[model samples]
Target: MALTGPNGPVMTREEVDRTLTRLGAERDAVEASLLALQDHPGRRLLEGAELSGRTRERWSEAEPGLGLLWSMFDTYSEALAAARAVRSRRARPGQSELYEMTELLRGRGVTVSAGQLPQGGLHITGSTRMSEQVSLTELVERMNTWYGRIIEVASAADAVWTALPARIDLLSAELGRVRALARSVGVHPGEHPAGDALEEMAKELAALRGEVVADPLAFWVPRPGAGTGAPGGSGSAPGTVDTGRYDRAARTVDGLRVQLEDLLRLRDDADERLEGIGETLARADATLAEARRARGEVLAKIASTEVPAVPGPASAMRERLAQADQLRRHGQWHRLGPLLDTLEGAAQRELQRARESLTSVTAPLAIRAELRGRLDAYKAMAARLGVSEDPELIERYDQARRMLWSAPCDLRAAEYAVMRYQQTLRPTAGPGRNSV
Candidate 1:
């Protein structure tokens, strides 16, 4: 009946079933009593106090009223046979395997019920019924649903993959036009020529592709709307003309388009030139997909191997901290950015794994502000720590950033450094002011 996760053992089959059954009955009673409670006189006025006891418990705890009711339904649907058997009092002997099977689900923050012999259904937690008391497993599941989550990231990647050629074509044409204008005035364009611009575009396109290929399921936000610009507006973002080189490819293709239009005006050689750009785009798409797969493999390394090997987020920090020192000694600040981003994501995720796997109805709280506060605190702490042992201090910073995985991150060193920063505060700021 016990479900094992990184945090510990979570809800037993027995516990989930009982909780669901109790919640369902309680909800029904509360709904029926609401009308009577609203119309009754005094103690007759209190004859059916609908919002008391468990109902009030759900409300005060900020649990969703409707979602809890539906949770019962999902539980019953996903584990119908087990639910029916539990309700029917037909217990199945040697049912330990049932608990084992649900281990994957419960570890993932899913609340499952049944398996008292052949009964099975999983009750996935909906957002509303979930509160802070909810397990971290559920939070991870919610992460799965989040806008910046892996699947959404993949959708964005596909979009960029699809849109890149158009962007590149436009930029390529602009480059061509600029070069022609430069030459017409007896001036040469930049030594690299319009062709070099295409190469730059290709490089950026390749990098974006590599990141996507490495992990289609992590996080990726498209360029405002992919290649910048509003939904229907012309591309206008600065450096977007470069689209980080995306524009180069776009304009080169645009160059061909302009050529085609002018040639049609004069019956010149347009068809062959336009077909060349089409070929480049077709090849780019195929190459992009290959790169995207490579990215997936990298993410899998973090998710399956690196993350699981660390025991938990806390331990993972220890491992990352150890590596960060070596990396910093080599002056590898560039590596640190991705490492921090990845560690932040993976550790926070693993933390949820621990929380969900340990306790049901005990989810961690939101920490958006905590994370920002930690970043600020760490900045000041790093400043203080950086004063003497700059190198050692940086090691500590890398370690601290890796170590503190809370949403609203925690800053142990910053708290320790409070006395150091005490005298550095602006004269006009105060305890009651926003200057802190």
Candidate 2:
């Protein structure tokens, strides 16, 4: 039965008993939640951290809010205990006990002083009352609101701190390795672009790490659909840690490491590369020398032939190769890399030019030899046919032989004489053409 009373309808004994059981469970849940918040790692970090920026400002308010949660919890606990005590006085509460139980469970039975609340009353309630009276239900709602706000701040700051600083430290360590490799290859700051960039990146990561440690919230981006009132959200966590700058720095370090590694490889291969270039230049010089000698022979043996002038050896490229080797000895691998490439290309071209010159300068001698072979073959064919003593054939053969054997040979005149001799032999040597 329900009785109309000042507080509200008085619950029946059964109703009161059921209500007590439910409120007791709520009380335990509230207690557990409060204790968990108290022992939260994020809360502890917030307490000890030298926070700055928005984090410091939010924590300033959240710190007081945390205290308020405990105080209001105390008030809620007391009201629940009082209601339980009134019911426990009798297994079946009388009318008066029922009235009090109704008020504690459903009516505004908990009173909170203004001093216990935040500056402008509870921000959730939107009230500035000097003091407030609320029911147990209202008290729990208020605490949930406070917990959401305070945890949001703590968890967001913690997330940023957890994600970035440690990664930056790892990257910094990798940066050190890259720097050492650069030094080994003689790629120092102010001498190589990668080295200077590495130095700048080191400074940036240091500053970034410091900023993350001091004010992690600055790097936090709230997740979409997340609310300020809850620690958990619809899709994901309340927010995410921003890693844009950190990722960029990581990519830069990787690129620098690649460049430095290439330089190291170049340093290891410098000797082999220098040796190969030296051989190429030497071959070019030998070819040019042979061409010069052949020019003298061609001028002596072949009359009125123009031999192309052979170029000098690749002196400039040889000098550059020497410079590159000296740089390698001094551990200046960066400078040697490009110089070796240029020198190698020039050396190949020099060798090709010298080979072409040798071919050109000896062309006349080759033609004279070819003519002499043809003339001797035809004369041999004539003798085999028993025409060696033929008056006309002997005269033509002697003319061709004199031109072929004489130094400063007239190649044009000798070629004509050989052709005339071959024509003279063709009619008589029809059966012996295959032998010739």
lDDT for each of the candidates? Answer: 0.38, 0.83
Best by TM-score: 2
Summed over model 2, clashes come to 1
Listed in order, each prediction's TM-score against the native is 0.21, 0.80
Residue 347 of model 2, lDDT score: 86
Model 1 residue 216 distance off true place after TM-score fit, in angstroms: 6.3
lDDT per residue, candidate 1, 311-400, as tens digits?
A: 212444556645654544443433443454555555445545544433221111112235436555745744554342355444545544
Error of 1 at 291 (Å): 75
- Model 2: runs farther than 4 Å from truth? 1-18, 94-96, 114-127, 228-237, 301-304, 363-436
Model 2 lDDT at residue 268: 88
State which candidate has the highest lDDT.
2
Q: What's model 2's TM-score?
A: 0.80
CA RMSD for every model?
42.2, 4.6
Q: Once model 2 is optimally superposed onto the true structure by TM-score, how far is the C-alpha of residue 434 displaced, in angstroms?
A: 11
